[model samples]
Target: MTLMKAVTFRDFGGPEMLQLTEVARPEPGPSDVLIRIHAAGICYHDVLSRAGKIPRDKPGQILGHEIAGEIAAVGSNVSPDRIGERVVIYQRLFCGQCPYCLAGRQDLCRNSRVLGENGGGGYAEFTCVPAQNAIQMPDGLDMTTAALAVCPIGTSVRAALGVAKIGPGDKVLVTGSGGGLGLHQIQVAKSVNAHVIAVTSSDEKVDVIKQAGADEVIISPDLKFSREVWRLTAKQGVDVVLENVVTNTFGESLRSTAQNAKVVVLGNIGTRPVEVDPGLLIVRRIRIAGSGNATYADVRRSLHLLATGAVKPFIGRVLPFPDVGQGHALMEQKAVVGRVVLSGW
Candidate 1:
């Protein structure tokens, strides 16, 4: 009956709904490992969960998906060697018996239970998870940076490599290029030797995106911006457009992509219906795809890339665990430059 401090929300609303409370520490099962959470990266999905945008089957749920910590204890059947090892957690817990899991696509498992959505999440002093979801952290990686591996880096890995199959010399345009995932997408594209054009809404993020290895950066949602993308590519447009914005930016992304190029939509920040000409898809042969959370392979590859120093994550600010509501407020206001991590639980 040991008690641990955790952030919880009973009825979904705004940041005010988030509350700090003491809860029972979870006991690890035979194949589970208990972790002392060092940091939890706040994401937009967490905001949506708090606002009731993402449905919750139960009440008083804790809401943080991206987590990084050290293994504190393990079940009797688990290996003792893992204790005290630093690790990044994979948010999605899948049923190994599902067809999707059998095909190595555990991200799409029908019965999958995401960490924050299913039960106890990372916004706690302690969390218990399956040993399979624990990924070893390389030396020199800190908790704040490790927390991003599960969401931002993992999503970029899934979209850029797993779905888009972006290759060397590929011309890629990343919309919403100033945000957490956008910056990671730029790094991932650069790692593959792709020429990256980052599109953002403010001039403030221009230099930031450029320093992250973007070949070019543009202010978004302007037809002139599309023209600039074409001009940069010698009027041929880009091979792939990472469309994370949901408003007119989506259409602009579609317009900026080269003939037969692919557009991968990952976010719904704008969250509005868009109009598209059917002829554009029919004649230009553009492909539109949706990507979600990372697979086990994606998580491993992302961590490996992070370990190799290929992807350096931009951490905006770190708030104390008790101030998770303030962190959420910063996120809602779009006040952060990169990932916002919560620490000192």
Candidate 2:
């Protein structure tokens, strides 16, 4: 029996529940490929899953979705030529037969399952995934940075560019600007020459957010940033709002947007119900869109951006896989400024 190191959780309460254990290595099916993970990006989703906030029925599940690795083995049906290729795993497992998948919108696949949300997660030495889900990493992109290509970069790209339709000379506002996705979104919005305003709750993140190319950084301790935004934009309001901390900031984000502006909701860290009054929407004509998981096309564009040096990754810390619990603890405490990557399992 082949054994591999994995961070598994049999209980759901806190970061202490994540245990380092030896588990049987998974084998690839005919259309699957086995990857030896080099780096896995820790996300807020993993923290929520550990706390039993995300829906999960079973225990003993590994909790990592952003994986970057080299192909260790390929199934009999897969091409042997793909062995040793560096790749990043797309965050979702989609059924190819779904209507959404057929329309090149796999992000909306009805039968899609998020990698870490169920099982066969990435917080391990080895993980088996469908050959189609493994995208080759672009040259000059390291494994550690590529690990974040899916969630932070790809998702933010979909939110800022695809959903919000950001363009040159546009005024863009980003909430939770110190987070993994927030940092990447700042860069994405800047890539097209948009004026970027970043909002963070912590004063410590103000400098870092400014360094990420934000034109202005606001420390909004009470989530009342719309007034500042209104003043900054000269009462015209911003053209788009990348709402990452949706539960707490959604209403204020809407108030900070110009007429017909789009508010793209990427994350809801509070995991609480949002209060929205439709009257504001009718008067402002603000469009609110929920940007879900990244599509395959989004990941491809993210890799291209990373390869071209258009967007740089901001990782707060990189720890050995045994310290997965510590990474989650930092996330739960909101101490991490950016993404926390785990390696060396």
Candidate 3:
């Protein structure tokens, strides 16, 4: 039997639960491809899973969703020509029969199962994924950076383009602009010709975001941030606000958005609920949307954007697969400036 090393958690709590173990390598089904994972990107969802905040019925769970690798083998019915192709994978697997799938909203499919949560995942030497989920990585792109093409880039594509519909001359605001997702959000927003205003917690991130095409970068939650954004936009609030850290800056986001603006909430690392005043919604007629994972179409579009150099993913560091605990700790401490990538086989 072929064996591979994988990181898994027997009990959910802290990073300590992440352990390296040897497991039987999976065999691909007729429509699946076996990938030898070169790199995987760590996401907050992985931390949420380890902390049991995401909720799982099973005890042992392998965790990693943003995956990129070379095709090692193809199943019997698959085209052998695809073997050896470098690719990034879409993490969400939907049952094709679902109504959401028919509507091109596979991200919201009723029978959707996410990699690293619904079953075995990419923190391993090998993983079996549907051929449809494997997208060809552009030539010359680093595998480490391509690993991020799935989750962070794809999510930003969905939020900025699919949900918010940001376009040329649009003024966009992104909260948590120093973080992984925030950085990509800035790039995606700019790709649509929008003028991006990034909100972070520190001055160090200001330059980082500026380099990523943010027209203005503000230290978030400071009274001066809203003022700076207002001044930059000539006292008119931004057209769209991408709110990720809900607990820390939800109210600030509400204040920074213009009347009839769209605010998309993606994540809440602070773990606190956001309290909204009804008047703000009623008077401003602002739209607030909750965005989850990206659909397969969104992932495909993101890959194309990356291929064209329209979006660049900044990878902060690469950690050994077994040291996933340390990686999670780095994220918890906010020490990473961009996406933290993990390497396996």
- Sorting all predicted structures by TM-score, with the top scorer first, yields 2, 1, 3
How do the residues 126-189 of candidate 1 rate in per-residue lDDT, one tens digit apiece?
A: 9999998888987888888889997999999999999999999999999888888999999998
Q: Across residues 86-166, which tens digit of lDDT does each residue of candidate 3 receive? A: 998888887878788889898898887899886578889999988888889879888888898878999999999999999
Per-residue C-alpha lDDT of model 2 across residues 134-211, encoded as one tens digit per residue: 999988789999999998899988888888889999999999999999999999999889999999989999988988
How good is model 2 by TM-score?
Answer: 0.98
Output the better candidate (1/3) by lDDT. 1
- TM-score-better candidate, 1 vs 3: 1
Query: Of models 1 and 2, which has the larger TM-score?
Result: 2
Each prediction's whole-model lDDT (CA): 0.88, 0.91, 0.86
In Å, residue 235's CA in model 2 sits off its true spot by: 0.2
Model 3 ranges off by over 4 Å:
57-59, 221-224
| Top candidate by lDDT | 2
Model 1, position 163, has a per-residue lDDT of 94
What is the model-wide C-alpha lDDT for candidate 1?
0.88
For residue 191, give model 2's deviation from the true position in Å: 0.8
Each prediction's Cα RMSD? 1.6, 1.0, 1.7
Q: What's the lDDT for residue 90 in model 2?
A: 94
Assess every candidate by TM-score.
0.96, 0.98, 0.95
